[model samples]
Target: MSTVPETGTLALPPLDGLGQLLPRLSRRWPDRTALVTDERTLSFADLDRESSRVARALQDRSIHPGDRVALFSQNRWEWIVSYHAVLKAGAVVNPLNVMLTGEEVAYILADAGTKVLLASGERLDAVGDELRAVPSLEQVVSFDDCGHQVEQFSDLLAVDDDPGFTPFPVDPGSLACIAYTSGTTGRPKGAMQSQRSLVLNCAYAATMHGRTSDDVVITALPAPHVYGNVVINATFMVGGKVVLRKRFDAEDTLQCIVEHRATLLEGVPAMYAMLLASPALEDADLSSLTRSTVGGQTIAETVIDAWESRSGVPLIELWGMTELSGLGTTHAIHAPNVRGSIGVALPGVQVKVADTQDVTVECAPGEPGELLVRGPIVTMGYFNNTEATAETITPDGWLRTGDIATHDGQGHFFVVDRLKDMIITGGYNVYPAEIERVLIGHESVALVAVGREPDPVKGEVAHAYVVLAPGQQPDADALIAHCRQHMAAYKVPRAVHFVDTLPTTSSGKLIRRHLRSSATANA
Candidate 1:
């Protein structure tokens, strides 16, 4: 192990606000389409005006700067406006996952101490009676008429001018947003993101992806996750027209690309798989799709090849986390990626693998170790969780990404697996991603996930859960044999279970914890 010099923080300009991106574009391309949904299309100027009105309305409700504002809505123009408006008011925007139930939503609201909530009717329905118990929640605004003291969204936009409203004192260091992790490991930790981090990330992404103003972007991922948060801001900053969808439908997503002549597609592995499986793909004209980005999960090798071949677009695998304000590394637009590598770190972002005990000591090239990243995109800390913050960020100022990874001399990175997800069998460490990456290449396997199975002698053993391709006969022994052929006997899974589908988060990240719990329950 060797110690690599930590990339020190830069002296950046005061970002002041997260909502500043759209306004700049509104001035430059006021007439260009900024947001598109099934219900409506909004130009840059329109988005600016509406978001400002929302800010003024929020101000009218006595919501002040530094307060917490929750946005619980499906992907819509209103949701986008509400996000910017909350930031413009200098309040922290807490974007809630649409799939979360009422109880889950209430827990976050109470924890975040959100004073105001802007929810769509559908989202409100998901968290109906549970919200009434939140004493800290003072106001609730709905997109449509939902009773129980919910104010209408249209009413907030009735007055456009803000003569009496005064902009709050905000700085680059202001806590702009709190993006909560999915809590697959434990209770969700709110990652505190600064205004400067958000702005800088947009520029970083634009450079990494070589995005231009002419690109038409399809935001297929949910608006709440970290991936969506950064993608939306970066796409807008690049002056790309965003097509927002409430939920992903493979056919609809492909059609939208053709209809809007979308140049970029953003989604997780599952979404890409569905898009590749879309019957319309065979005949559709997807020449407009120049780039497709995938992350937040392990992508199947076959799925990657299928999408790229069918659409004639390259699938750029990316690596990021909520703590990084979104991304840390990506494949350069014109550069070829190493087979197992995610790509080089973005400009101003430094990534290095380090020994588990000492973050200062770097791992040898091609050796798997914890990845430590230092960049403007890294978060301030976990909100209200000082212990976790201390545990995650090294004293030398590197955010200890819990994912295990390796990089070659050329700077290409390969995310092996989550540190927490590492399985110890017979005193040897096994990474599920390595096994899954190998298994996914098999002809019969469509999707495969590896989990830790309890074993009496070895302490724990690997178990494979696979979903076979359509019409293929279930053959667990064949897969086990395949693993044995490619990997050492100890690293191969002891048993295999065939399933209809594997569990995943909205972003398509395989939730191994869920499978582990199920394995325990079954055992």
Candidate 2:
């Protein structure tokens, strides 16, 4: 009964070649500001020319069509340029998280079979050894001239543009990027996205958000993630200007929003919490912002009410995942009928609830079940992992989103929880099993269960319930130190509660849900 277009059958323009699209959009916008970082501003024309130059440089390095090039850097103008350059050169872009450990980096590079990596100088040290370890990576390009072994990114731009290099012809279904999602099992699997998937998602997001050329978007999320990628793509689709921040700093975010008069903002719930708690929230001139959107995790009604009261702007909630290309459901700002619900499915998307048997079920008003989504925006499949692909995507093409949700009679949906035991801390997914496996190896830990504990800013923080071996004891500080030595800093527990025994089922399997509930209640 929704007026929006039908699911999976929307007639979208064919997006066969991203290389051609960027140039054409540049011509249309011409002098319009396309990107603005802390240090520089690039107009559409500048982006076109520079990206072309970078594309030619990529070709000079033998990065040909279909090659996968990893981009490991923070949010910066260079990151944008690199993204366009890779696409223009007909290579797939694999953006790596700056926070990932060397082992994780090696796993991704080896898994994706990446040929080259473009990294910031500061991040080079973290992955230098890993890059060397992976024989498939032939070259390393650095954004800064650090007198290192890596090629300078600026030097690449100085290369003469190749006039004869024709843009490669590609089908809309050809792979565009392989975004890796942290797997519940072992290693992460790359969610293979097509050219159509990426382009259509951006267009749809822009349309849903009512973005215009006059809109100024401030992005605090890291570009390596799908959320940041979608925001950048959407902004460009509408010829909107973007203000990039390398990292999220509450005070700096306030200053940037005020100074740039940012009209739109995309952040996670933690960011909003920080901004609201900061002293600058009361004094900063945030009047320029007309829309503020939060996603990656849930937003409490209390936080929403407080933010709306202070900023005089409603906070829109979005529900999406990396596999969905960064948008599935959004709370439309202008919708009068469905106010609080994650607005009706975006154009060309279909949502249904399924029982444990995977059969579609109609929720009578407020009943919650597993949320299943099917659409063009959904990923083609997990790259190189047929088993995972089969598990996530049905034979009929519906993608099992693994989240629990309920819908009102009016068609508005509300997400309840995720089926996977994944923790979303500070907007980043942290799997407890991964951390528990590492913790149990510690000399002081006999049994350990990692779970989520409620936090004011992050919504949930990693909490560890540890039981030491008999006659052996490790303090909270020491156990935390041990975790930091074994895993990424964010994966380390923010708080460790010493316990005598961990709750387990009759079969001797650890019951993580009970541990999580106990930890939250006691916290």
Candidate 3:
């Protein structure tokens, strides 16, 4: 049995499911502002009533416990309502990235066996009839009045109040959400997050950060992202107000902070960089910000210092993955903020750096190795992929995070690199295998390999090294445009290098680590 670490002084009320959050908060602070969007603001009471009505609508459509319901849309009040409503209706919520192309969405919906889809009108339009091909998808609900064959989300909120309606009972250990994350297998894997895992993560993360009802947080991270989910749900758990934006924009983020007098700002490292570059940031009133958080990818200390010097607030660095439901490690609000470290594991969680060759052997304090975690925050397993799950999680319950890190003598963890070839750009994960898979689809590309290139604004961008077919002329723009159709814009390579050959080992495996140096020499 794994030993559970002490949680210290944080106290949280027990809840069976995420559906209970709104009802409990409404009773505590019904009239308090629960959510604020560019379109409108909603109180806790309003949010509860609206979500309940949607849950009723979902039930009306025959959604039930364990049924998969996908929410494919940008950040909006309806998306938030739909998330809670799915849980209330006793269905599993699968929030999808808005940046995903229609084909990608179709694959996820089909893979998750989604029974219903709640999406924005624009998203519905973008996907067109692609989602209809998903045999498991029984219904489509549009957030706006789009001419798609779908139900109107507005109609769901128009129903009569069912005061006696109660959310369905669910075991805390049952799956609550299926978050898809790109993996090295050239496909996205669904990380099965249990109700216990997600709820406890929110409680622990919120407590560690000293989140309270008095806080007003401003975030522009997409609603589908695991980090974004934590930011939204954690705030809701404490009855704090969340200022949701459709997307991240430097100027708009600054404006929201000044306008709302936001007590906390949450975003990835790239977002902070953008804010620092924003002309409005110099004159922006950020006095209301008591502290801020930066995560998703490693950030430069200079950028952290710049933000703190200008805003006069602590920039807490955190590390997490979809497999963990949200945060795995972070600094407590009262703890010492180690400049480069990702901080210690959340209370009740155990983290260690293991030898790459032998995971059973722990690495020395200053030695770098694979980071492994064991806790309730870890995902039960990858959805419907037992092979992948077995490869990731040890028999002893340690989940291999695929991240290279080292532990200081004081318990702080510092990430050194990624053992996996996955690249993170602008807080979004981009797998090299996925990009290579897309590139290989091009007829002009005889052989292809993808590698990460250092970028200034975005942490890293994909760079493709290709060996063209006979009689094929290399046109970088053409290949890039082809990628745009098959993949999301962010996944497209920043540059394409045409080379005669790529470095490969005797075993015929393309050596990605040596791609940059080889490509430079060959180019």
Candidate 4:
């Protein structure tokens, strides 16, 4: 018997690196539509040629092997080209979240030692002088025409494509990406993933999801996210078309499924919630969707059942993190649907629940513990942060996923809670410490602690408990406005509670779990 149920006839292609993905697909399916957007559509051949031209431009700029090239833009065709172009140039990719503040972007760029920055003109202008502070940045390329000191993305694409161009040969074990994930320490850390890891993830995800040439997927997930990256690349790996959107609008998404005749619809739970809430959902034609996927956070079984029942499609729940490169566990399309569970591990990956108190001990079935993963899918470690790497990964190579999960005897894993205080708001990881750091910056804030608040749409939202300084009156609006300015919109607290004292241990350590009770008592 197969470790995973055989779902589809789509076989994994021989891929050593992501750089080879487009070139190989273009050769076999040159005329097949590979990417579709409202702005334009690209055949496999067109995508390959455009990426080659951009790769030559990057090489001309002296972007050598292992050099960091950052793409800081929303989902766009150019963003896709830049990704493959960076790989073809034998450079490491650093995809930045478009929602990041100028300060946050600067920190990541500087930390990754990004040499070339490819972004939208608006984002560059927003960062303005901050880009200059990063000494490692040698060139700034914008997708749109911008002010001085930046190269135009169109100009690079206009360059003559090297007929003999091919992806630079690099070891499969070599680092291919530095994905920055926000940590509990109030800063983002880069997860270094190898070329083999990424390529395998795409292959496995595509195979398990039953993606093939006949499939067309619609998604609005950010390209910078590992989940989004896999969804995009997995489609390309099997010669499928992707109807990529810059942002998620429930009505628009439902319409796209009908318009594109999409076979797969993929998104987080919040997206499904919004889709269910949309008035268009009742009249929208969803006959084409054979399967859909939800991940990035745990979703209620009710939401999954409601979606599957209404659309006549299966909602395949999967679980993963940035450290896993893409997916650690997901359901095979042909397998039994196990609602409220994240299915089983991908074929070659190993997953086990270790006792929270003693990681060396494996938890019994139905016993919740910290989910530990050991496999090639795991990231090498946090880039330039050995201390964090050691803390997260054991000497034997088991990656502590920081998720409290229980393994059913039958191979399914059910997530219970987060081992860390980090909140998942609309599928985005919101570190409480990061929020606390920003909220503490406010002049009126004396002591602040952030915690997860249950949200029907977002799964969980950040709720802050504040203990104001002496002589300061409660100003929830002002404090929230302050966070809005310093952090991304998603990371902003939905509500703030003014408390006389925050719940803490006798040693003065703030307890995040008790925050909801404190809010209730104060109210």
What overall lDDT, based on C-alpha atoms, would model 4 receive against the true structure? 0.86
Tens digit per residue, CA lDDT, model 1, 1-523: 9852222221224346667665666666788887899899999889888888998888888988889999887788898999988988888899888778788888888888999889998778777799998989998989978765789999989867754444455788779888888777678888999988888877777778877777789987777787887788777776777899888888888788889999899998778765654566777789888988988866766678877888777889898888988778889888886554678898888899999887888999988889999977789998989999999987878999988988887788888889999999989999888788778778787777899878999998888887776668888889988888888888898888887777777767788867755445444
| Cα TM-score per model | 0.92, 0.79, 0.80, 0.81
lDDT of 4 by residue, 192-263 (tens): 999999998998999888888888999888888889999999998877889999888888999899999999
Off by over 4 Å in 2: 1-14, 162-166, 337-340, 422-523
Best by lDDT: 4
For candidate 2, the 10 contiguous residues with the lowest summed lDDT are 4-13
What CA root-mean-square deviation does each model show from the true structure? 6.4, 11.3, 11.5, 10.8
Tell me the tens digit of each residue's lDDT in model 3 across 308-405: 99999999999998999999999999989999899999999999999988999999988978999998889999888899999999999999998888
Give lDDT: candidate 2, residue 16: 72
> How does model 2 score by TM-score?
0.79
Residue pairs with backbone atoms closer than 3 Å in model 1 (clashes): 2-362
Model 3: weakest 10-residue lDDT segment is 3-12
Which stretches of model 1 miss by more than 4 angstroms?
A: 1-15, 162-169, 300-302, 516-523
